[model samples]
Target: MQPRKAATADVPELIRLRAVALESLGTNPGPADAPWRRIARHWFDERINRRDDCVCLVVGGGPGEPLLACGMAWITYHLPDSRRPDGRRGYLDGIVTDTPAHGRGHARRIVDELVGWLHGAGIHYIQLHTSEAGKPVYEAAGFVPGRYPGMDLITAPPGP
Candidate 1:
């Protein structure tokens, strides 16, 4: 049970773990050919690697081998009106856990480490959204459901 930061070279394994995460949600949107898969891979490669706020933790299968579990978090800090910038109320996003490692608390452990880091950095809040399957782990970690429902707005470019 090792927990460590994921490197850029780990992109392929991260993609595979993401496939497992999506399938666990039920419904195969088809193999990595799905548009969402491409988008996710791109996001992981471009966004996570470049952004200081993003972190991806991975667990290797053995001493030095294939990756088996992974978790990601994007830490955002909303600045207050007075502060110049960087003053933040941390928010964690895009978290995923590999399928075979699900019941072993790997996800919870990963999240625990992330939240600890945030708090240590003086972050006031650390929040993440979860699916029904992940609810138990979050709850066990003392996470309570948010009072208001969350929403998202999707946009698309003009079609050809």
Candidate 2:
């Protein structure tokens, strides 16, 4: 399936796919009006098309149809170091598809496209976080578990 580059108008569907991903990871994305949803919609609208720094891709969503699957990534930089040289890295943020679309290759197709885009951008170091069910797709695209596991520290959101 041909995945389309997500546009501002695709934000809602992208949000829907994010909720799907969160649920698949066994976490609630909260209500539709959750603050994070609002924050994400605004971010996607402004950031999706930048191409230089980020990308979001989706399958389906033609006319009135819902999105079949979606995936996103963003690039980040760290100061040049011996370990990473230029220190540019691509983070494959997330990939999620509607339940009915499972067993199809849509997710892997999106991953392949993202990887191609990253490689074309001269990013050799790519990383991703995926559930056990999604590992095969990423592995097929050449991602292996990192020697360093990831950790996150939740912090209070800043007041507006």
Candidate 3:
């Protein structure tokens, strides 16, 4: 089935899918009742319902059921470069499917749609960090290892 753009109602299931993804990558998902989950609900509403720069898609499930897979990406801006004179970039936040739905081409379809959305928004440079288990799907979608290395700096302590 074709994936559809996620609505605010899908926010909770999307959070669950993200946690499942983190666990698959061997990262801790933390406690279920963590305060951050409450805040995340608001963030999802803002980003998915009120924003135009983001694209989030979900597949499977029904009117009252949990979702099977979801994917999200958003635009980013950087100092201008030759390839992207406008400096518009696409950051693929993540994609995930419930364990029962793995190996069914869900990730590929979601990635394809998310990429299409980004391209529709005039973004050609897309980037994402994939787990080893997820690398093949991304590669098949035309993603290649970039020449530039990824680095990050911690600007603040974790938690509120």
Candidate 4:
């Protein structure tokens, strides 16, 4: 499968693939509410079209075809550090492969492409949060446990 950078026209499919990824993680956003879909579509549309720091990649399928896998990366600038002298880091997310398309190395291909692109763009640090099922794949891809401890601050509950 050939992995390519996603374009604006692929927003809808990217959203669908994101939901599929969420489903695999037990957070499937089923078609129960139109508002959520609308919100997500709008968010994705804007991000896909207007964001220079965000990028989405997909493998397999083309126009009018279902994507076999999809992944995204958001570039962030952090304080300069020894490991990341330029401070540009890549945060990978929404990596998913269609159920029937598993075991075909689609996710790996997408990750590889993303890593190459980020390296070419001078991003040396990359990170991702993966599910148990995805740990092996990521480990095999040369991602070891991170050196720095991670923490999160929940500023608000998940409702709008």
lDDT of 1: 0.72
Candidate 3: misplaced stretches above 4 Å? Answer: 155-160
lDDT of 1 by residue, 26-130 (tens): 857586577876787778887556877767777775545677677766666565656325657566654566655567767778778777767776775667787
TM-score of each: 0.78, 0.90, 0.93, 0.87
Top-down lDDT ranking: 3, 2, 4, 1
Q: How many Å off is the CA of 72 in candidate 2? A: 1.2
The 10 consecutive residues of candidate 1 with the worst lDDT sum are: 77-86
Q: Which of the numbered candidates is closest to the native, going by highest lDDT? A: 3
Q: Find the candidate with the highest TM-score and give its number.
A: 3
Q: What value does the lDDT take at residue 102 in candidate 4?
A: 95
Candidate 1's C-alpha runs over 4 A off are: 27-29, 33-39, 61-64, 77-87
lDDT of 2 at 25: 88
After aligning candidate 1 to the native by TM-score, how far in Å is the CA of 100 from where it should be? Answer: 2.5
RMSD of 3: 1.8
Model 1 error, position 76 (Å): 2.0
What residue pairs are clashing in model 4? none
| Model 3 lDDT tens row, 24-121 | 98888899887767888898889888999998889986798889888899999899989999999998876988999889998899999999999999
Between the candidate structures 2 and 4, which one is better when assessed by lDDT?
2
Q: What local lDDT does model 3 show for residue 100?
A: 90
The candidate, 1 or 4, that scores higher on lDDT is 4
Position 95, candidate 1: lDDT: 58
Q: Give all candidate RMSDs, comma-separated.
A: 3.1, 2.0, 1.8, 2.3
